[model samples]
Target: MEPIKKAYGYVTRTHKGRPQVLVFQHPILEAGIQIPKGTVEEGESPEAAVVREMIEETGLTEWGKPVFIADDRWKADDGSIHHRHFYRLDQKDVPDQWQHAPSGGGEEEGLQFTLFWISSPGDIPLARGHGDYLPDVLEERPEDGLGCLEPSEDVKQVYLIEEGVERIIGETREQISFEEGGTVLVREQTLTSEEIGDRRTVTRLMASTNRPLTVEDSGGGGMRAVYAGDHVIIERDGGEKRVPLHHLPVDTFSVELLLRTLPLEGTYALSFHAFNVLKGEEQLIEIHADEQPDGSFKAKVRFGAMIQWYWVNTETRELLKQSSDPAPGLKMEFRR
Candidate 1:
């Protein structure tokens, strides 16, 4: 197989009042600004190839002496591979007269050009095939003192749990406990009862996690209950259903810690929505609440599907309101 050969050159310069770096605009690609470079023809010395490529591409005649940067193998667009030689030319020697070569092909090969000054290695965009060589150049000229030219920060670790009443905030696992003494409203629909009598459905209101509280029946005629992170499984119910928890709609979940600690008074609004995971569609349910003088609040929530809404007083660890709607298939209760 015939060996594939190509060459390109890059220029680095310092911008006045800005960082010192090299700049070159790509003629064909949009937002293509980086070091100028092109391929070398066959039988040409690597150094001579870079010189000729730079002159032909940038119109710079006085390209100065080519400084060898590195030599490595690379793959080209034609699927053939070749060894590449890289060199850097000082911007000080750039000739005043330089122009782009006219395209041998017609105008459909759109290309544009621009110039910029660069100081540090990080100032160069990684796209122009110079991404790898940029670091080497910067290391060789650390004294250039390019400001704001550094690698990005690493992502921090975090812990996320879907179940539970407490919002886990730290990176480690920890238990959150709540004390007693709170109010609970139980709503039941019964055909034979006084409120709505024989076939009756009852909803108990309480404070738990952001989702509804569920009571399961154990197989042995016992009962099992789960809310947020708390679970109690007896011999009664052996089934389990997972519910989603979300804060009142008005409060936008953000990375800002202060927003999470803000007092829940006239501060925000809440909305409920039904999410169909299978279809990736959502329908909003209107829910409203107000803070009471005793540091407690109340809200009425409704979703297309039976879902639970709980009002847990963060300060006193109380369940303020728990309710369910038969029409929506939601069941909930509260205990303090």
Candidate 2:
């Protein structure tokens, strides 16, 4: 089915250690408060359309990076297909209350919207379920440490150690060591069925930097890798090759390293290697996080068709559980 292309931005900010979302209501229309969203123009990308909508609706010129959250095609009242792309952005400078007369020549050109900040966007009255993803976005954000955590020199830092056993057509033991701003290490030993009868392998990754370094030691075969600027340098079978970073998924091992380096607040772009090796390309993964009611934080990582959601504890900042798309995907939980 053919679908109309549309884009929207869920803009947010932090005031007094709490994350607040931006919602607006029209002066005349008795509709639910909605976000900045609109249709994509000819030859324009969804990413570009979202930013343009945000500026037109809110009159705000500065914002953090935008993370693409959800996109799908749904049927409208006319039975027409509408393909929508949603993104989340964080801005810290917007006032608590303001009025904006949409500046673009669009459906909302002359419409004036009264904007307000809400700590819990779910609690507010919205128009046509426009804020439906508030719960999901809020659930994904980290509760403590503002947003992404930064290394603190004054406070005493603690490391979290977790161990678990996982089965994926086979059984394997996993151990993860996470430090606030230090190196994160993940080690795994696996035995799985493949073309070569039974395969046993031990893999390790040092994901301390934006560029992750990985090494695998097999009984006979070994592989080594390093992520440089915009490319991944891999060594295997005594041969080396450089692959663009966008083609790889960065959260292959875990999200601990990504969390350590994320900006405290605002939109940001990140890169990671895919959990599984295929053909990798360098691309920017837009991401956002928010605190939950239970004091835990959640993060959303997007890499094209691959989406990773992480639930982390508030005290230890350790991963609690992870869910992802794609069959045979990585699903894990941390037990006390």
Candidate 3:
């Protein structure tokens, strides 16, 4: 049979003085751990194919040029011959780990992969001989300051919050869906309790590495946002307004939602301007994270004089508990 051309990538970086290689694992346990690789398309050079495969399979939006490494030919179990080109690309400034349902056709269309870095690929092993060429291309890397913390991969979370004699129940789900344009990452959350006025449901959607395209809060004055060009078109209280969102000088009003996705390190801090959807006014918000002695993490989500503590698991990134005393004599708690 004629040979099928393919390209494979060894996306490498440094975290805390250790050399690391990027890899992924399919949700289906049998697929095993893997590196970003794919079949080269007709008329496409292997170099171009390498980058395209890395982006599509690994969900990386930003990357540098790839350096050609080596080549090999192998016969598949199906008796088809395959020619593979391997390349190495350096990566920078990204979260420790993230999840994405690759954008493409074929058996990968709906499969989600948990993408992360490992100091050694052989330790965990990549399925289907995906690591065959690792010994030829692996190299020590200089520190990139990417930090060592990795968010857990769990997509479904449930939490219970309490205050004084009152309680609030919250549940969140994270997933990817094939939409009109392509794959859209979605986070849906619901909040309810015996509290008289605290029933809320929020849905957030993001395209690629882009900021949120929509943030719908059914409880907070019916606040909603739609991405339009470089600005966010917000609809509320029978009126609409637009606000600018940028890439650099990164700023976000969706701090609470972002915490679920950001990799939490021993120390994390960011200050940005945010629109108070409930107040209909712009305000400054600050969020900080620090590792606890128990290996879990806590983030201070403060708004005005009220501060809430978000506790998350170190390895799983699961929300273990959250508590806040918003007012005198009132303590609120949420436990998973």
Give the candidates in order of TM-score, highest first: 3, 2, 1
lDDT of 3 by residue, 127-233 (tens): 77677645434543222211121222223323333343553344433322323323234445544444334444343333333234456777756877654323455
TM-scores for every predicted model: 0.35, 0.44, 0.44
Q: Give the alpha carbon lDDT tens digit for every residue of 1-336 in model 1.
A: 454555545565534533244555566675466565555666678788888766655656676777654444444567675566666676664433333543322451445445555566556564535554554444343232111112121122222223323222222111122211222222222122232222322222222211222222222343333222111111224443333323221111110111122245753455544332222234465545566676665554444443545464646433444544444333323222
Q: Looking at candidate 3, what is the lDDT of residue 16?
A: 92
Q: What's model 1's lDDT at 22?
A: 54
Model 2, 64-159: lDDT tens digits are 667655454444577776677767788876689999899887566677899887777547777653664565355443333222433321111111
Q: Candidate 2: lDDT of 258?
A: 55
Greater TM-score among 1 and 2 belongs to: 2
Clashes of each: 45, 25, 9
Worst 10 contiguous positions by lDDT, candidate 3: 142-151
Q: Provide the lDDT at 244 for model 1.
A: 37
TM-score of predicted structure 1: 0.35
